[model samples]
Target chain A: DQQVKQNSPSLSVQEGRISILNCDYTNSMFDYFLWYKKYPAEGPTFLISISSIKDKNEDGRFTVFLNKSAKHLSLHIVPSQPGDSAVYFCAASASRSNTGKLIFGQGTTLQVKP
Target chain B: DTAVSQTPKYLVTQMGNDKSIKCEQNLGHDTMYWYKQDSKKFLKIMFSYNNKELIINETVPNRFSPKSPDKAHLNLHINSLELGDSAVYFCASSLTIGTSGAYEQYFGPGTRLTVT
Candidate 1:
């Protein structure tokens, strides 16, 4: 079963415009959420993460917002650039378990058109 | 310097062959993990090791075995590979602190295995 789901398989946006990617999870036990960006033929790179105690976390141009009640989270990239084009994956881990294992979504491909 | 590195970035073998993949991390992290991305692009965890000790073993097949000689190295050996085993495997490392749990993990470039 896929505990984390990224409904949108692909997204396209113009350069310098705002890009929003969404993710949903069914496992409420997951307390820490993370976003990773991956390019073709490469491994995923860590982007940003948020703890359960916080609703939002921002790093540079990337921002992640989490809604516990809705079991949903989103990543917003402000003034998207062409380099931002890649597959974005949403991952979650339950800190209570402390195994460091992550449940990942199917991933969303975001394309920024220059 | 590469934080996490895996040997044989691409592997092609027959269905009944036995192969091994090696992974090393220079980040000095205490934990290492193996993840597999299937054709569907679903990334799943297969095993995790902390300080050379097995900590987490998912519902993977017995054909897949993971060995950790030290905190910085983890290896995977697969026997009698099946066609369904063709996928991209990633090696990752992270640091686990007191009660804060695991920090963000660093990943390698990934190894793509193709079974004929």
Candidate 2:
């Protein structure tokens, strides 16, 4: 069974618009959620992360929102730029004692067009 | 200054052959891991080691083995390679098992393994 799910396979956004990526997870033990961005032929790099305790965390242009009640998380990139085109991944980690493993979801490809 | 690095950015071999992918992390982290991404683009964990000690082993086949000779190096060896082994293999590292609740993981550029 997949613990984490990203329903959208791809998303298109106009440059300078907002791009929202959503993720859903089933594990109640998950305490940490993260977002990663990857360009073709490169590894996924950490973008931003939010702890389950917090509803939202924001970086320069990227923000991650987590709703514990819904077991859902969303990543928002505001004023998306052409350089922001890439695949975004959502990951969750449960309490570490048992496994503390970070599980990933199917990626969502984001295309920012000028 | 690559934090994490994997060798042979690409590999191509025939079925029944054997091959290995090498990984090293210079971040002085205590934990290292291997993840495989299939054609469907699903990323899954294969193995994880902490400071040369095997800590986590997922439900992977016995044909796949991970060896950590030292704190900085972790290599993966696969035997009797099958077409099903074709995928991009990634290496990653973290501070600990998130033992203290540290949850960041750094990854390396993947190795594209092609089994014909």
RMSD of each: 1.0, 1.2
Candidate maximizing lDDT? 1
Q: lDDT score of model 2?
A: 0.92
- lDDT per residue for candidate 1 within A1-114, as digits (tens), equals 889999999999999999999999999899999999999999999999999899999999999999999999999999899999999999998887878889999999999999
Please report, as a residue range, the 10-residue window in candidate 1 chain B with the lowest summed lDDT.
Answer: B96-105
Task: Quantify all predictions' global Cα lDDT against the true fold.
Answer: 0.94, 0.92
- Residue-wise C-alpha lDDT for candidate 2, range A1-114, written one tens digit per residue: 999999999999999999999999999989899998999999999899988889999999999999999999999999899999999999998764545478999999999999
Binned by DockQ into CAPRI classes (incorrect, acceptable, medium, high), candidate 1 is medium
Instruction: State the lDDT of candidate 1 residue by residue for B4-55, as single tens digits.
Output: 9999899999999999999999998989999999999999999999999998
Q: Candidate 1 — what's its lDDT?
A: 0.94
Top-scoring candidate (DockQ): 1
Error of 1 at A99 (Å): 0.4
A102, model 2: CA deviation in Å? 1.0
